[model samples]
Target chain A: MQAQTQRYSVLMVDDDPEDGVLVQKAIASSGPKVDFQFVASGAEVLDYLFTEGRFTDRSSAPRPNLILLDLNMPGVDGFSVLKQIKSDMDLRRIPVVVLTTSEAETDIVKSYDFGANTFITKPSSFSDMIEVMTSLKSYWFDAARLPTA
Target chain B: MLAIYEYLFGAASFVPHGYCLAWRPDLIAIHALSDGVIALSYFSIPIALILLLNKREDLAFKRTFGLFALFIFSCGVTHLTAMIMLWEPYYGAQGMVKAVTAMISVVTAISLWPLLPKVLALPGPGQLRKMNTQLAAEIAEKNAAQVNLHQAYQQVEAQVVERTRELQALNQRLQDDVRRRSLLEEELREKAAQLIATNAELERFAYIASHDLQEPLRKIQAFGDLLKSEYETVLPDEAVEYVRIMQNAAYRMNKQTKDILTLSRLSWDSIQFDSLDLAEVVEEVAFDLKERIEEAGGKLEVGPLPGIPGDRTQIRLLMQNLLVNAFKYREPDSIPEVHVEATLHDTGAPGTGGACVEISVRDNGIGFAQEDAERIFSIFQRLHGRSEFDGTGIGLAICKKIVENHNGAIEAVSSLGKGAVFNIRLPTSQPERREIHAGTDTAV
Candidate 1:
């Protein structure tokens, strides 16, 4: 079953390098074998999604199966990015999960309003991070079916 | 006798001379007409004077004018008799009338002499006209002055009316301003109430978040323990030490977060206040702290305590925190001795009539500096290192928060190397009677 399954790709958007590294480490430890990409800014996420500038080549910048979005960023913010992605016909079908440190109900509601597939609070400890990543991998890669590109 | 008779007869014969005097008709007619005209003029004058006097009863000197008229009439009557004699030649009658006229003439002359000065003093018509003109001028002047005075009075009345109108307008503006100010004040009060509610909501959110945050930390500690125990042989010594250190750090973090949660939850609105005896609360705390106290070789002396209005659970927590602190901060080589006592106090809060209970927990412990007395009640504040005293440093802060939840106050006074006393003051009854009544009435 594992050999027959197609490997999934995930684009992670976060400004904190340490958090990105921690996620990478946690996923490596407990998650499925999947491709991972990291972007530091919401602008970079948008550039990569639109295949603009340096990401003009479709083969080098393949569209990911899922997007892990962070809310607070220096510029272009998560809500704007989410709005852009959901409004566009080509990108609206791709699943976007909001992973943020905010436990505010407003943030959760707003994420759903922008067509976020999932909303999750970032775990504080490394072991909890690992557990959350394992659950996320299991649910997204193994249980749910993804749309073909 | 014959000679006397002859003489008398000769006297009768003497009138024969009158007969010899010529009987001229012209002379007789002229004399009669003259006398009649004189008499008529004199009598008419007196009648006119009388009539003038009667019409003008208020005329000055009326009696004098009457006497003057009567004298002139009497002179006219004498003339009337003389005219009668012209027709009848009755000498004796004529003579008698003449005598009466003479007497009237004499009286008139005498009276006229006395009244002459007064009659002359009477003003003439020309002089009276002059006086009338002067009086008329004086009256005209007075009328003009009165007109001017009336005009001035009217002007003053108009000014008063205008001033009253201005005052009324000003009063209206003042009322409007007052109304607007009151409205603004009411709106401000509403905004302040909203701000308070928002702050409370934020506090609740913080409490819940912190509580949820503890779960991941617990998991970390639990898994770290699992790794340490289960992989003891597989893990290297340094790796094992790192895991243990991570577990210790996670445990400390968990403790701090829990304290934060407690601090946040202290503001929860569901606390119930009831009348509680401090003696009972102290006894319970003593029993809870019995093992610790025995290990520290401490003795707790509880005196009589008064009943106070408070939340029972919070007050119990307050007593436990203070009692534990008393046992925890004991001086080395000195047996820990703590005294719990309560007395009636005057809180001086408005409307409560200063009825309160002051509970003091005193201990022979390693007291802090006087300046740090206030600092000790801040969360996580520590005077000594963790190795010196085992505490998260949130105990006193929790105590303070709990006491505050009951609308009470707590204070500590201590000097370095001396003992410390923690005093808690709580009202014996709710301070605001109206609020209590409202709460109870609405609660039902």
Candidate 2:
């Protein structure tokens, strides 16, 4: 398994289009630009990661460097999605970062328990979102090594 | 003592009722001896009287006196009668005087016959009991009077104590009333003072929500406009995604406005009241959340619900919010489980009305930190992450308001990751509406 402390393509699995867009802006402001993709639901993420059906071009779709998950989405929320990602041995080493709009303790603890690499709160302001994104870039890209592409 | 035996012995004289003894010196010596013996009779009555006087007090003094009087009178009469018999002379008058004196002494001794046996009957212990029996009724009457007086005094004392307690309680009530009135006056002043501050706060909140939050939201919306209208065809996928990000923040801002507005409205002093069946209200909520429950692969086990007096709309809102929260915070490994139970109780519990009912909702989900147990019922008190769970944080707060409106109580108990239980107690029977005779209902 590749070490989690490496740069790879990131995925955002969320239902809210608005939240997905906000997270994208936050990531853009962050340094050491990395490739990223978005999926609408846990099912789509799983299918894309597994190269199933619509996601058959496995070579083109890179293994996720990290996953930013939302727990309260349509079908098979973030927790179930985390369970599947962590359970699959081939994909288990990939880092997971939980990006949420709440600071509830239960979510933080559960995110860690399910093997998330980091838990970040969704900023209420656009500027704070930028800060969260810049920090993510510094920690994951500048301070840590990236897996060979 | 010698007096009676003298007669029985036939008192001898010097002359022997003739001149034989008087004429002979030897015979006269023998008569002198007999005369000397008869003279000892006078000492007997005094000795008998002394014996009678020994136990004198216990004997009714009057009876003793009367018996003594009888003794003396009979003694005198017998003495005089013997004196007359003795005076009937024989041959010589001087000699007859001597003989008569002898007969008088003998009769005086015999006078003790009737009185002797009676005098010997001194007071014994049995006589005391006999005396007590005779006087017992009188003694009892006097004692009964004293006891009755004592009992009446005790009753009076007890009444005084009871009155003292009542006066103390009344004084305490008055003191409490004064304290409460002062508190109310203070609260009225405080509320009056807060009216201006509250208005100012409300205005500030509206400004923050409208302007500060709207800046980024508007920028996001404009950037989206700029991208879609100007560069939609030429821009790369990544560049278009950037514009979409800005637009998403704006849209969320618009939604937050509505949520905040509803929260502000919740602060309004709107009294909720309506007489409705609580059971039917819960059923409606269960029906509304049926889809969520099924999707979670959990069943909402509703136990028998008791019909109670409450606001139907507010109660329905409370059940809906909590059940939603349960489903949202489901444990990863375990399916969500919720048990809703309601029952009425009368035992006049502390938080309960003399006749009140309780509704309990227990859930098996990801429980929160113990510290959050109380705060979870506050506005915007979310225990789980927004990315992990979705909530406005005001759901439990609304439930609290609904319960309080019914003059009821609500509380939550939870352990970390173990589960949580919410208990709600509401007055079932209005104090004034209670029947003169209440019907007991124990529905478990």
Candidate 3:
């Protein structure tokens, strides 16, 4: 995979720590090259991206090339994060894929309207999650062009 | 004694007056005729005066007229004595009569002096005529004023009648308005009752959806999948079966939670009504289920459908659910064949009369008994065993709710061997275009 030569880090934002672990496993099953990172809340996403608060270490907290966002969080929801990311010049280039358990039309449309690159319903099965991650990996890392870091 | 008697009787000592005239026949005759005519006129005048006095008893000074008549009678006796002396002297009797006439004339003259002023004070005929003319003019004016007053009374009467009629009309209109408002109020009361009952049901659904159950259920399914995928090589066959069972149970529970959320959303959110082409909706659903249909070797024939007023998302879901049911409940051997068709029909709903589109979805599937047709639309109601068919059993219930939100009707008909048919009726046009907000005020 091209991720071996160019290490790509993906950040996932969710309030549920278990969903973060499951997604990390799925990413591992998809490929060995891609690095997976996690944040527990939407507010922590900004901290990790801007190197603020607990994420002040420059070397430890790197800018992610992609962001996986969950819509139903306690505070600073996915929509507000998407809006802030899309509005910022430095963060707008990072592709955001909304992976939430909501299959609501309003959520999907709102996610896309807020400049989400993709909207995916979180699958229940581990195999389905692996399939989603594999396709996402092949599409974003292999097929699609991205801004050079 | 003889002298005294001759003075009283007169004519005994005197020769006749005819002798003094040398017995001239012409002179005698003239004196006698003149005196006789004068006496006759005086007597007739007294009689006429008496008759006048008797007829006019109301005349002023009646005693004066009687005295004047007596004086004239005495003068007539004197004249008769003159006529008698033309032949034989009657001088004594004439003197006595003259004395009586004098007395009566004096009395009449005295009475006339006082009565003259009273007779002059009486109104004359010309002045009375002028007064009568003035009285006639005043009476005419009074009559004209009476006529005007009568006309005014008539006008007032007409106005009263007109006002009464107007009030009656206004009262009738008010009565009609009251009846209409009462009917509307009755309908609102019924709707409020239904809302109360529906709100109670929605509360339960909301509780289930918001219970944080799906998260744990999803984790269970995902961990179960992970065990099978990662630890299958080390696990025994029995452990593998146990993992599979746990995954199936979790998957079913996850589906139930998702279905509950869908039901709660229907009761929590305001649905948007729009003009929707149902044929296009069916095409989209068929395209979405294309793989399933091809895998089953099924045929979905869509006939001409109608455009109806409904919530687009809900109507799309309705079509998807019905078609998915047809594909899901198919017999094992038979090729799944589903026909989608529509017809224009009248809803004939009271106060909501309009045309509706009747869409039927007939599927060659494992049909349920006729009795379970109505029960299938209930929430979480399932006729077949969970092992036989894969469903959370809320699809038909959602369909029924969607139809109700559109103010439409939906029904299902099926027998044991025969195929099942789902008929949905949607109004072509909404009556009295008011925005409808279904469910509770709070969003789930």
Candidate 4:
């Protein structure tokens, strides 16, 4: 209910730095007054999510309303992280979205199977990503009422 | 009495000695028989013609006409020879009669000459009549064709009128349609745009999902590790077992998810086509898997491989997977022996036939039930226990997909406890084949 008035915090984890920056640009361009956090790998997400190790300070590490993940990573990949996040009672309440460079059907099915709330392939061009983020703002921010757990 | 007796004796004694039908002495009888023979000889031409002309396809007129000509000529020969033989007859043997018969035959032979010209002439009576009939038929056909054309023209005129009206209506509709089409095209373009966007969106979603999911997966793996490492001491045996099982499942899922991503990427990724020597590829794979093969105490045998248009990196991966399977599924207490052979097989039409290279990899592995042969090519379909043989269960399926990308097929032949041989076929042709066809055609 609080998300109805207040802007939601988005936590995006991607191995590619350019992409992470691109997503940030897209969110900003959409004119949404939102908090954005970027983590390089899936391992960092755990520290951030559970408030453990480097993410011990809760104020600096805000509770994210949404999480975007990339399936491919060097160590402790995306699907494994998704399963664990969805399995936990506390973490399961937050909406998780999957982002990839491929429109592969298997990833879509698998991501959802692991309890991903939404799936989106990262657009190639800057403009397309901006457009998608604009529509996403229309849908997630305006159209649909997200669950409060 | 004496005169009557002399007349009777003279009449009785007038018959020539040894005069019989076999040696005919009577000129009238002989002449009559000669006339009959001449008549029959003359009729043979028509008889041969009748025989030949009975069936439509039996024989043509030219052959029968030729036979008729021969019959006339043969009859002339028969008559002339008969006249020469009959020159000195007993009862009515006369030179004049022979001369007359010879003359008739010579005249008849002359008649045969004109008949031949008539026979061999380009157009006979029948042919001329046939020509007339054909001309009439052709004229009728042409008239029919003209009528059809006229009807068609009338129909076309009607159609044009209707179509013109349709065009006017269509012109109005077309304007609407053009706008609609533009709108539809735009809608399609938008739909395509959205689909593509959604596709990209989906990919991003997967990436994000994978990225986000990894965090929790790592935590599961890590916490499972943490629990095992830190909390295993005080926990109950059942709890420890549950933690271990959880970790096992989590790790298994992690590996499997990663493998599934990899396998699916094989389709999504672009395949590079280059001339790859399969022998060289196999050798490289064999070298890479040398340690594994040696550990399994297995031997790798290779064959004369055909060079093909293929992706070298992918092919190397293909060979690696096959060899790995060979090494992984070896018989109990036996060294692994894997043989990789490639040979060209002929297929299709004539000298310009295409070539298919059959690459077979045989291994003395723990063979499967034959029914499971096809099942092995399915994703996540495993024949053996994870303890007995460890795999992502997508190795063969990936191999099949890779082989199929090259327009090839893969088949497995094996029996339980014996061994397994995997056969892969790729339809490949030589680059120089175009040159050969071009050269031969040029020579001709």
lDDT of each: 0.78, 0.67, 0.84, 0.72
Q: Model 2: per-residue lDDT, tens digit, B45-93? A: 5455656666564554444444444455444444443333332322243
Ranking by TM-score: 3, 1, 4, 2
DockQ, each predicted model: 0.03, 0.01, 0.31, 0.02
Compared with the true structure, what per-residue lDDT tens digits does model 1 show for residues B1-444?
655454433343343222323446676677677788989998998999999998998897777687778878877887776676665554555566677778877877787797878878999999999999999999999999999999999999999999999999999999999999999999999987786677566565664556446646655665675566558899889999998888888878777876775676675434667778778988998998999888877799999988877778778988998998888886667899999988886664324547678789998898889999899999889999877877888988999988776667889989877889998877677633112111110000
Higher-DockQ candidate among 3 and 4?
Answer: 3
TM values, all candidates: 0.54, 0.37, 0.65, 0.42
* Per-residue lDDT over A1-149 for candidate 3, one digit per residue giving the tens place of the 0 to 100 score: 34445878899999889889899989998865687889989899988888999999977788898899998788798888999999999999999999987766667888899999999988888989999999998888877878886
Q: Rank the candidates by DockQ, best first.
A: 3, 1, 4, 2
lDDT of 3 by residue, B1-444 (tens): 876556646786777777788879998888888899999999998899999999998987677788888888888887888788777766665566677777777887888898889878876788889888888998999999999999999999999999999999999999999999999999999998788778767765564464457767889989888888889999999999999998889878877877777776775567777788888999999999999999998999999987888788889999999999998897777899999999987754223667778889999888889899899999989888888888998988999988887788888999986889998877777644343334442212
Q: Which stretches of candidate 2 lie over 4 Å from their true place?
A: A1-149, B1-235, B239-257, B347-353, B429-444
Q: Write the per-residue lDDT of candidate 4 for residues A1-149, one digit (tens) a residue.
A: 12457868889898877677777877887766778999988899988999888899998789888888888777878888899899998999887888875455677888899899888876534556678778776676677777754
- Clash pairs, candidate 3, are none
Q: Which stretches of candidate 1 lie over 4 Å from their true place?
A: A1-149, B1-42, B53-75, B86-190, B193-197, B225-245, B267-273, B345-356, B401-409, B425-444
lDDT accuracy of residue B392 in candidate 1 = 85
Local lDDT at B21 for model 4: 37
Sorting all predicted structures by lDDT, with the top scorer first, yields 3, 1, 4, 2
Docking class of 1: incorrect
